[model samples]
Target: MLLALRALLPFSLALLFGCSSTETDTSTEGAAAGIALTETGAHAVTRSKVPFLWREQAYDASLHDSISIITIDQKLAEELTDAERAALGYVTTFIGSECDWDGKANPEFSNLKCKTLSALKLGYQCSIEHLGFLQHWFRNDQEVLIQLASCPRIPFTASSQQTFDEIYLTTQGDTINVWFSASGVNLPMNATWEWTEENIFLAQDDAISLVRTNKSEVIRSELKFDEGL
Candidate 1:
């Protein structure tokens, strides 16, 4: 069975949810409901059985605030067991202004677990707006997966566009694995996805694309996954 679930906030609502250095409440007791503040005050998570957490700080002067999933839980990154790290999936730090393409200065520590979808490249700027995450768990198997994606604004010949990076995590028995993918294609702001048992159908404007869940491959087509649409 396809047990799919996702979390998102409309652009307008997401903007209201955006946090800044000065506006954030540093106290753990004052955090929003269902959210817990990390010891360092750099991250927060939903207080539930399967918690969903995110970076709270946008820029870390010492770190230059580059984009990364490994640093999401900085304190725990070093403390987590290999198996625990894998189960957590690819945790990303808060979106900041800079992008570390070479991974030299600001390396994403768990690179082996955080595999990319396409050749990494430079872009204009990262967007914190509409940043979202999704989680999926198999009923019959001892496996769970989560994806954290962000759309960044990229300059195009005719206009600017939004691109995404798909970060995923999966667990099996005592082992866990993490994966990352970049949507090399530029898409409109309204792009959306439909999940099926084996594939994800992406729709934007009048075009549709199919993403194979197993191989992490994409197939573009002018027709919709469901012809009726």
Candidate 2:
């Protein structure tokens, strides 16, 4: 009987180990489905969970006045964690605007518009006419690159039109950089000649400094990020 018990012990242990292994694999597979990691390894995680928070303060070198723009784009009402939603409550008073963050029935574009205008402070006359396409290119888990093909522009008046302005960003990891570019057609001749690129690098404490690629050009501005972004 002692010999039979010893022989059964090994089989029992093996069965237990097999069951544990299967359970582990099942759990891992379930997690993988939610995370949805691609084989290419470029995007370690999708943007659905992560909060896209950033504020950009751009200075007009010619006018010498800086504009503070805070953007919170995502399905914030639906996707934000309880903690994140609570964070919004703290800032509602300071944001100086009311928004009906109705993510359930709202489409992606309308949701973005509501999130942007509600969370950020803008002048009474200025209103963002449109929110353009947002493309997120993630290099890894720690790094995310975003390109705004047509950033929203607030026309001064109802009849006024806004030209297309493209912006790019590298958010996450250690350093973040942003670039703004725009072009327009010359009147009469109708030739598009002026296409400019203004690059800004992240500075200390929610600020960005102009990166002067041309040694001769004295173009500089201290673009700052808004708080609570």
Candidate 3:
């Protein structure tokens, strides 16, 4: 499964990032907003509509691996063109990771991405799943942080699983911040911690769901917001 996913990554990256226009934009407004620009000076952008729904597949400790899937409702899926659906799945695969094992060394950083599990089909809803390798470092004494942010310019790769430290939810203007922390950080290093944040630009009814699995137990949380950023 891992090898198959790897083989498809290059094609996926091209399909996801190849459609941008070659024209350059000298507008100062874009620069002030921290928008990324490509080598050609064109804005690096994603066609994804804001507010994604996340679904985590069951975790198997024996294999030290798991999958996270994202999907849209049948109604929303119907409205998107084939290209749009593929882009949406492609972008959601990027994830940020910070892990502190043994509470002695600095946290290790990595990236993760979801692969196309089941694209649009007659009997299947459009969906993508990320296959991740759970790091053995995860323990009750260590801290692990996983992040999923929208509108990413590039995809990330990494996979690990453990227990979540804490779940936090806060709102800053129009964006919602969701932080997950654990108890094993080394005080001397003062390493930065990351969280999940989504800018609600469209689709008022859209939401994000988090699923955490530890052995046979599973905990799920859903976040919904009313305003747009």
Candidate 4:
């Protein structure tokens, strides 16, 4: 995960949904979902779930072309109890640690120093809050779709509030955005997952596509895991 030090967005959010699109451009549905990684099959592989999520750009093999799923440790999932929120919060800490909390209370793309967990979490919080401040963007069906007249030129704030912006989290290792509710509003967000080459010890990436019901296809991510825990 440390190698992903350069990939992160500050002040992010997560609001996942289970519904996905049926379009065949790499269906991100759950057949791609439900992973139970083990010693032999520990390498990062791509899987597709039931519902296919939407993407601004159809398919870019250059970027992560498939959703990465690292099986969650049953013990941790049980121990965390509040895995949903707590896990997401834990991921937030990463964005903060990476961005170094410029202390401006605003989302700045240049704050790419996200090399630590604490920095990333702070960065996620700051960036998400700023995104929530956008007008004409809101959540429906527990999922959020942001829309702006024109996307921003800057990578960080360029599409923070745009409908078709290509959003992602490097700290989460090239995972797409997650859906979330903050300040009582549902917004598209990101979830973070941490792995030690093979095992899924932690997951913070929480985008709208990671839902348990009526899920959308836009939030699914993948793990290009290494072989061994």
Q: State residue 78's C-alpha deviation in candidate 1, in Å.
A: 1.7
The estimated TM-scores of all candidates read 0.25, 0.26, 0.22, 0.19
What lDDT score belongs to each candidate, Candidate 1 first? 0.25, 0.28, 0.26, 0.25
TM-score of 2: 0.26
Which 10-residue window in model 1 sums to the lowest lDDT?
A: 1-10
Global lDDT of model 1: 0.25
Candidate 4, 1-229: lDDT as tens digits: 3223212111121111111232333223332343333333222322212111122222324333332111222222232112222323333332221133343434444333222222112233324433342211122212223222121222222212222111111112222223321111112332322111111222222222222312233333432223431
Measured by lDDT, the strongest candidate is 2
Candidate 1 regions with alpha-carbon error over 4 angstroms: 1-52, 57-71, 89-99, 103-186, 192-229
Total backbone collisions for each predicted model:
3, 0, 7, 85
* Residue 180 displacement in candidate 2 (angstroms): 3.9
Each prediction's RMSD over C-alphas, in Å, is 17.0, 26.8, 20.3, 19.1
lDDT of 2 by residue, 44-152 (tens): 3222222233333555454345433334443333443222222232222112121232333243333322333343322111122221101111112121112122233
Q: Which regions of candidate 4 deviate over 4 angstroms?
A: 1-28, 31-81, 96-229
Give the Å error, residue 199, model 4. 7.5
Candidate with better TM-score, 2 vs 4: 2
Candidate 2: worst-modelled 10 consecutive residues by lDDT: 132-141
lDDT of 2: 0.28
lDDT of 3 by residue, 1-229 (tens): 5444333322222222222232323233432333222343112233222222322344435434443322223333344333333333322333311211222222331222222223222111111122111111111112221332222222221112221222222222223233332211111232222232322211112222222322222323222222530
